[model samples]
Target: MAKTFASQGDLAEKHTSFTEVGDGVYAFTAEGDPNSGVIIGDESVMVIEAQATPRLARKVIDCVRSVTDKPISHLVLTHYHAVRVLGASAYGAPQVIMSDAARAMVVERGQEDWDSEFGRFPRLFQGHEEIPGLTWPTTTFSDSMTVYLGKRRVDIMQLGRAHTAGDAVVWLPDAEVMFTGDIVEYHSACYCGDGHFADWAGTLANIAGFEPVAIAPGRGDALLGRARVAEAIANTADFVESTYRPVAKVAARGGSLKEAWDSARAVCDPKFGAYAIYEHCLPFNIARAYDEARGIDTPRIWTAERDREMWAALQG
Candidate 1:
């Protein structure tokens, strides 16, 4: 049987887990759905990466309320993906923060992304109608910014282009906990549709420099120790290298996109095939890798129409 395009046929529900990785830091993860991190400060709370919809976000909010009643004062978007940002309205945060690059992406392709992603993963957008439109950042920074939840200091830093042009990681310096938004996926497929394959590896190195004691990755279970953290980071890097390197080699030889995809899959599927979203992300990841290998620096915006055309060409 032919494979489904993206996640169009995926309908099984995933169990959600809310784990407290640090003193006041929490990770909200669904099987392979987008994850969110919560940091409770002395006076308020900062949430990283809102889920796809307000209805989905409420589960995180409920988890937050169960632990602490602190007001959610800030919402941090690690990048400009619709599944990660469209739930901003539910937080009622005065400050919605992201890197300047992310803000620019929101302006450039936010709507297109919203439409594209929703079409790809309808389960994630259960309450799509409730979305109040694009989630805009009230505050944008160039490189880094810091927020104080009383005495607690959470540093938001953009190490380099990885998952996206504006990828950011939330670091709690004192607590030694890092919320690495899709920059370091553990046991999950790295979606390279909007990724920078080369830069992403370097960004992972930067993340390693922090030597976090605990890591709240964008997906999978939280990494609780330095060893696990190291493993997750290395696994993410390996996945990227394994996928992009093969595809790049094929593209350099003037191979067709399908040829590039097959090369990448041959190398990746043996190892990463069972990983969450591996199949869903393969086509798009290969498409982006093909473009990058052929010298396309900026990733083209993926509208719903573009998604269908690409899926048809690749999967048919």
Candidate 2:
């Protein structure tokens, strides 16, 4: 029998930890599951990355309530992904923000992505029934935008494309803290299905240039202090490079998708085989990397059918 999707078998609950990496700034992480960040401003709060469903989002809300009573004024999504944005309704923030490219993606392939992701990872969408619909951004910026909650200033900028075409990172300059969504993962695998492999490294470099004192990564534990922050960034860069280099070489030589998969496994398995979601993400990551290697700039829209077809090709 064919193997099941790694995530479908991952029904076990992860112990969620709410850690305060910076003063008034918190990270809500559930083992290797999706993570959310809270930036408490003077009078209100800004949340980064909503969970997959209302039920899961409520867990983050509970963590937020545990710290402060400030109402969420803005819901900032780092990228346009079902796992990151579907639970947005639960936040009830007046201003839902995204980069212009990210908003365009929502208009283009949001629904398809939702259908595809829901089929891949059922455990993340615990309260699928409660999801209102596709999440839309009420506010969007082209390059960068700064929002002020009373006296506190939060800068949201798209430094470069990495995990997605319109990936954004939240920088708290005063606190020297950063909330990076999927751009940097400590021990977890970087989901590169919608990634830009060539540009990912430059994006990581842009993030490192800021020299953040603390970083709330997209997955894994929060990185506190400059040393840990640097370590995660370097590790993420290595992961991105390690996956792309071998696959690109195979594609560059006109190898088939299966060839690319074998090549990637030979390199990524030993280093990242034990990472969270490694198996689930490998097929998609290899598919995208193969396309990128062949000069496919824009990632093809992934529908549920396409996901399974690719999985069977790689896993069969």
Candidate 3:
């Protein structure tokens, strides 16, 4: 299984960075692991994207304590991914929020995803046992909602779908800063196993319309300037298109999944090989792209058994 998931052997710890992207906005990023954002309001704080487990969540809590003692009033999850929402219990925030579509996903395949992700990458779930169970949202919105942290007005909106069906972005109108869950990544592979390839570019356009000065992306470094923000958005769009186009072409030609995989590598490796999680996400991305090209509107649920089966079949 030479083409097995690289994350299986990626157990080394990544160095974490806490960067302030706005007046009271912070991005807690670990090398290229899942990132979390903190917004300190006049009276309380709001956190975006909980880590994989309570143990991991505590690391974010530590960073919040370093700057302010304000209690965490809300924990906003960008999607229903296990690594993003399973740590919700740790926050103890009275209001846990997500998009209404995200909540339906949690009820649909949340457990399977938790099992699949835990089996695929154990390093992220450092304290798996501490996870109470599947995380649920106390509050949900259809399209948009606003939460005020004293004077700081944070707008949470489901701006189309890219990484997942229910991707949400946290925006600060005053600071022109946004916390984009996984809709955008900086120098990190965009995992598209459950993504909407066709709508991804449109979503990028929506985010670009806001002209954010800074962004705390789902992974990688915090974008601090308009130049960097623009670059990341453009690069993310490029990555999504690059992965989908080649694989889609292969499928349109009636090629097998393995053939589609080869086509994707031929185009992507030279351009994105240096990115974090590039290898780990390649097989899944290609599989989904192939499916989408074949008119699979909804992505099939990924289970632990299916993960192994696909890896074995894709093995070179």
Candidate 4:
């Protein structure tokens, strides 16, 4: 029998933890699941990456309330993925921010992505009925923007495309801490269904340039200290390269998609099989890598139909 699609069968709930990575910077992580970051400035709060549903987001809000009563003034989206942005309404933030490219993607493929993802990961969309359509950004920037809460500065930047064409990161210069949305993952599978493999490495280099003392990655435990941060970056890079390189090689030889998928698994499974969501992301990641290797620069939109078709072709 064919394996379940994505995390559809993952019904068990994970244990969530809220950790203070820096002075007022926080990370809310749920074992291998998606994570949210919080930056409490002098007066207001900024949340990075909303959870999949309003109910899930409320948990993050509760975490924020536990730390401070500051009103959340800004909600920053690292990319345009349903799992990351659908819960924005729960925050009631005045400004919802995202990169220009991400905004365009939402306009283009948001609904399709929402449907496709909902079907793939039913557990993540706990309160699916409560999500009011798509989550639209109130503000968009081309490359970078800065938000000031009193004297504290939070630099939001689109360093380069990696996980998605519009991937962005939040940087705290003074505290030397960074909130890297799926741009970097520690001991978690790097979902590359819409990723740019080669460019992602360069983007990681740019993130390293900041020399952040600590990092709140999109998933997994937060990395503290420079050494741990560097290790996380390296692990992320390795996962991307291990998956992309073998698939690219197979495609270069005019191999079939299944051949490419097999090649990627042989190389990546031994190294990353134990990572969270590794099984769920493998087929999608391999498909994207194969397309990119064949000179398809733009990632094809993944509709519900396409998702099922790909799963049947690869995993079935």
In candidate 3, stretches whose alpha carbon ends up further than 4 angstroms from where it belongs are: 1-6
Q: Taking the tens digit of each residue's C-alpha lDDT, what string does model 2 give over 6-92? A: 478888889999999888999999889989999999999999998899899899999999989989999999999999999999987
lDDT of 3 by residue, 25-105 (tens): 899999899999999999999999889999999999999999999999999999999989888888885589999999999
Worst 10 residues of 1 by lDDT: 1-10
Error of 2 at 138 (Å): 0.8
Which clashing pairs does model 2 show?
none
Kindly report which residue stretches of model 2 are placed more than 4 angstroms away from their true locations once superposed. none
Residue 129 accuracy (lDDT) in model 3 = 88
Q: Model 4 — which ten-residue stretch has the worst lDDT?
A: 1-10
Q: Show where candidate 1 strays beyond 4 Å.
A: none
Clashing pairs in 4: none
| Cα-based TM-score, every candidate | 0.98, 0.98, 0.98, 0.98
lDDT of 4: 0.93
**lDDT on C-alpha atoms for all candidate structures:** 0.92, 0.93, 0.92, 0.93
Model 3: ten consecutive residues of lowest lDDT:
1-10
